[model samples]
Target: MTKPLDLKHVALSDLHISLLNMRHKPKTTKGRSNEPILDDILPSIRERGIRQPLLVRPEPTKDNKNAYGIIAGRRRYFCLQAIVSEGGEVGGVPVCIMNADDDAQAIEASIIENMARLAPTPMEQHTAFDKLSKKGKTIAEIASVFGITTRMVKQRLALGQLIPVLKQAYTDSEIDNETIFALTMATKKQQKDWFDLFSTDEYTPTGEQLKAWLSGGGCITVEKALFPMEDYKGTILTDLFGEHDQFADIEKFWSAQNAAISVQADEYKKDGWRDVFVGDIGRHFPRYDYAQRTKEQGGNVYVQIGDNGDVHFHEGFMPKEEAKRIDAILHKKPDADSNASNRPEMSGPLLEYMSLHRHSIARAHLLKHPKIALRLTVAHMLTSSGNWKVERDYQRTSKESTDLSLTNSRAEQELATERQAICELLEYRCEHFQLYQRYSSPFNIEDVFGRLINMDDNSVMRIMTFCMCETLKNESGAVEAVAVLTGAKFEEYWVPDDGFFDLLRDKSVLNLMVKDIAGKSTAEYALTDTAKSQKQIILNRIAGQGVENPSPNWRPKWASFPSQSYRGKGSVF
Candidate 1:
């Protein structure tokens, strides 16, 4: 039933090149084609001829006997078929006789022959390398054959180094190549989260654009969004709430706030284009939630911008087991500051944050929405404006770090710190609320700072000083002085040496002042609760304490409040 001939000529229609074989070809005909690119060789081949002979070998037919298998020269085979189909005299085409070693060795010989012509594209080279690697070829051997360095070979190999899950994403049209490359380059989870949040859409994105999104976060999208400036109406709210008698007095929201605050999760979430929502304040914390989604990039999440401009880096999600290890380290802090220990360095606000996250490539496989590594612990305060989109991203500046540390608190000093914090907090007063034409936050953190500006530590101390004066008028000289000023005479009350008098000075107004924290002897001047709350952050971060607790409470220093617009036919919720 089968022909036993070494060669046979049927019509071009009778012979079809095997697509599977062509795809698996050791040599890509498109590349390494000494025959010239089609655009260049179109004229010549049309005029002259296919100088090289096509390679083929005899094979046993499935039905019975002898036939031929293409050892190589797939292009020549096609060329001959085309010519003969057109009724050209192609009956006597020259062909190469070849022998086989092993299947892989045979493929290598075929690949080598093509490489002698011209080297292929990186992709082609990559494929060939993979085949050779499977065939037990070394990088050195492949490089030598292709006349390339091993580093080049390795870089190409790196392209295929994506996680299996990510590779599946690429296959399923969930992600692209450049994004994979960006993920490859990411050193932290936050960076990875940026892409994951941005890439979460149904459409397929080009690899190049995905890479741009992964590297720059919202930079590309922001550029596009900003272009339609006419569409973006920024109504700056001057001061919608007037410095009123009732609202200001009854609600302390206007008098207390810090400057830049942040909200993230224990697990990293995908956040790209999102809206900021602000919730009520005094139901404990009427606050705004800053949320984002990353769709284009994935892998790690890292955030670093420290006191004294020192930059730290935090990695992506951590498993529950790892988080426990971190917790164990936090229990035995040496100093009160909680900022100075290396053991606790794995968690909290530090130079290297690798453990706060709760998700991982391995973990993502089991969970749809795991706990994020960091989320701001604020009462829902996500104003429309608070929903800040991914604006842009940059590499952490390593040089910005100032190598300083901090310490913890003792009982008396702790009391004093808390008092000072409270006193300072009370100092903030609304001098006047500028009437605004509109309401609603135009910028991200305008309202939080607006309140912070009115709070002067000294100003609050003066108020407390007056209040104390009236409370202690009947107490006579020293006791009265200690109750009012908390100066050197009053230091005897609550300060280290002032233990006996500390009771009389217990609620003194002056203890909470920032000026009180100046002395090294915290024993002599206990920090007020308000003082500890306010400066505890700044001092622990920038001032650098000697406290031994490595894991400190991550009191996010970025203070920003969202404002709602009431002028646009809406009630101020």
Candidate 2:
């Protein structure tokens, strides 16, 4: 008592505690928000000294004006306060008087300290991000600060809001990233749909089944899965125990009859996939008695034998001899009513895309710049843009689009830049494409020639999009889309349309009908027979210019069209 207590080495419980003159921290529980581990701290403090230090501020009350306040370690201070109630010898704990003079300093210090030492779990990270997300932080800002991709950040953040059971299971490694991402795409009800499967001993579902279920995309709850087994098509398949079921009551009837029955058809033999699912599932499989002849294969039919490879069935074809006899026009088309194989993806949307493109092509035909018509179509290599692996958005799948890893930092930047380029290119091309169609249409340009070219990637894409969609409408005083194409000023300078029609209008090699949208004239240009003879050479020059041309796609195909046609068809549309 006489000598001053050395603050260096003392139990935290031996210290007095008080709240500082600071704002309430009710919001502190958000995102890695530190809380007094009241549960652990109090109990642990009763047994030993606090292992960590807590930051404190000077109290501002009149009575304790000079006394220190607790800025942090409130949880630690609380444990000591509890100990002092238990008649603990609370005195002389070491304290570090922070130099923070204001509340802002205190918060900044706290954040800095936490950032320095606290490496939160993914869950914790997501929680922190969630708080910021609510404040309207964009993905770019999040990515820049975290040095991670927005996609990754969004995924983790989404994981935090999942059901407690799913979240816990995920944290414990019961599930996987793909499953979680797939689940994220589902609604709460849809998520509930699979809850029952997760409840019992058979919680684990095959990857394919899970994917199929999730792809249905709707509200799914637990109650739905129990009564009716949702078939592959998300339809109810009841009387599940009946004859038409995938399962059979062979055990009830067969008793102990271990029947060895093997059935085959010529179709499975012809598909050359004889070793595929059927070979193993059909051969050496027990007759569960559930057999349904669903469809025809190559020249015959197929049947399920028993449960094999995560599935069971008793497969064998009836009317097998007749179906297999005629190999003349056999096709592997299952009966319409059959529910065996899943439906191939619907192509209606694809048809819609074709419809749109077909409309565009028609518009292109009526365009002032005419194009060539090949006798055949070239096969296209389609890749999904999901991974950004390819340039085409139509070519990629979701998974593949996500998988497009940039080659490096520079490549990532380039990809982003290039994507922007494509967007802008669409702008110009769409407008230009539409402008031409409106000015030139329903006319054949078998004899016409021209090529539009561009060096700027972004400008090129704008041109392409213009071609794909329609040309843009500039402000009345704004530059004409055609002017950009022709490299001309529109102030009454002799900047004729300078496009396909303008170049081929009075030319001898080609013929085209063009109405000057600028109120100039409607004229037709036809290529002479001599020019047609040299069409190959002329076409090559235009093609070369298109490939390595000085001008942009804006130039009318006629303007870009190379003369001296000794080779082939020139740029028509």
Candidate 3:
């Protein structure tokens, strides 16, 4: 053979375009010497310079020196010239030098290099391949020179048989590759008839419809199978004249196809996908409703099945709302619409319920523990802490039903009876006297002091304890602390009722409460039920009605001293 080609860095001034260069001139512009368009490649040369070397041959110059003729990279050569003309700096161009006496080899090298860089039009490849065929080169040899398969070379050559009008239309990009490939399957007469129809202003089928027109309807080719062909148990029909093969049984094909889709979904789930949703057949997956995410961020997979029995898996996608929440947390941005952002676990009504119940328990416990009450009163007086001016809590409720329930509670009744006893002991009474009112009694302060001095020390201390307990603030943190220190028993003072259950809005917390009161199985069965149904189950179990065990003394977590919330949020303690 031949010697291996040598590579050299040649100066830009000594390089000239060779006659074998495939794109040296526009193919449509015959009889004109216009330069090739340099707009697309100019900016790249200005910034990155020529990255790939040009293929050139040695040429004899009149000046007695060997000049280089460029067989490839002609566009790059024009880009360099434009840069130099604009006063831009360019270094010596890298070139691979070939033998001086081989015109066919130069043409082959030019076609291969151009095909490798930017893909040429199908018509352009056909013309170049046709020229090589005319030069007595076999299809296998042409494919070997270009490093491609023989079948690919033959397919490119087949485009040369198209009518001239269709070739011009393809060159002008008026038709796409799919339409041209489908048209290639048509007979010469069929192509002529189709072209005659296309010449008019009437409707013309293209793309998939064109393929359908070429092959009659309901003919799905074997090339579209996502599963193994060996697994198909049905008959496969072959159209030898058209060179098309298709599955005959549509139902059997879909069964195998759907089974393949499920296998793919299971694999994705095993690969750490959070969800795998298989869409209905023939329904397009709505991409706009989802956002792209990484696999590590709990992204899900979507299995889309087409009407033609094709399957596609879209991985690493999440719903738009969830993706926004994750992105905001990752990027440290604020997401106003996210419920998990800055949301309290307990609701407003739940907070009010905890506060009022804890306040009531604290007051009742203080009534019995006079010593703790004395210490609490002195501390409040010394620090001026928390409504120390002897102002009673208004005990406001959002709902009238809640107020009625609280007014009839055991703790409220005990406190009212004790206050009546204290009023009698002090001999101070008025019809208008109320627990939450200050200075509503008609008796003077001097008379009350005189009555208190004559009473026993224990009796006077009990009166002082009552006054302190009545004046404790409704939602104060100090009341929660005192309730804990005094060891207040919630079961002895409180019970669940409709007013309490009505305020229980969160179904999750209600489920936990059901699990606590009823058995775990019952709670699990009731998890899917509505809040009203869950509340009824809780009521039924607590009342020992239609249940094995009665939890009559059961108290909510929030009712205890140092109150604990079911959701672990908005607790005063």
Which segments of candidate 2 are over 4 A away from where they belong?
1-118, 135-139, 142-147, 160-181, 204-209, 217-573
**What pairs collide in candidate 3?**
none
lDDT agreement with native, every candidate? 0.37, 0.39, 0.73
lDDT of residue 562 for candidate 2: 29
Task: Estimate the TM-score of every prediction.
Answer: 0.28, 0.27, 0.35
Stronger candidate by TM-score (1 vs 2): 1
Model 1, which residues run further than 4 Å from truth?
Answer: 1-47, 57-66, 113-119, 158-180, 183-573
Top lDDT model: 3
Residue range 390-496, candidate 2, lDDT tens digits: 12223233543233322223434544454455435323222112223222221112211112221333443343443322222323222344445656432222122
List candidate 3 segments past 4 Å from native: 6-16, 28-44, 47-52, 58-68, 87-94, 187-189, 211-573
lDDT of 3 by residue, 1-573 (tens): 988989878888899887667666544443544576666557657899998799899875786376888999888888898889999878889998999887778778788666544455667777778777887889999988765667777777878667877877787687787677667666677678778888799998886676556544444677768789988887774433234566667777777877777888888888888989999978887766776566787878887877666667877778889888877788996666776667687899999999999999999988997765654553343223456444566788789659978888898998888888876776543222343333332233444545555677687678767777877787788787777889888778878876888688898989999898886977775676667767767765665554556787888888888678877686735
Better of 1 and 3 by lDDT: 3
The number of residue pairs in model 1 that clash at the backbone is 118
Per-residue lDDT of 164 in model 1: 48
Q: Write the per-residue lDDT of candidate 1 for residues 1-573, one digit (tens) a residue.
A: 523324434332323232212224334332443232233233344456655555555444565344445555555556665556667655444554445334555455555544433233344455556767777878888666544567766655554555545544654455544455444433345344654565676553344344333333211221212123243333211111111111111112111111111233222343541222222332221111211112231223333332111222232223345445655786755676657665643445543334324435545653553221111101012122334321111122333211110112243344345445443453321112111102332222344334433545454344334333323333245443463454332212221211222222323332332233333343222333333233432243222332333223222111101112313333222
Superior candidate under TM-score, 2 versus 3 = 3
- Cα deviation of 220 in candidate 3 (Å)? 9.3
Candidate 3 local lDDT, residue 113: 67
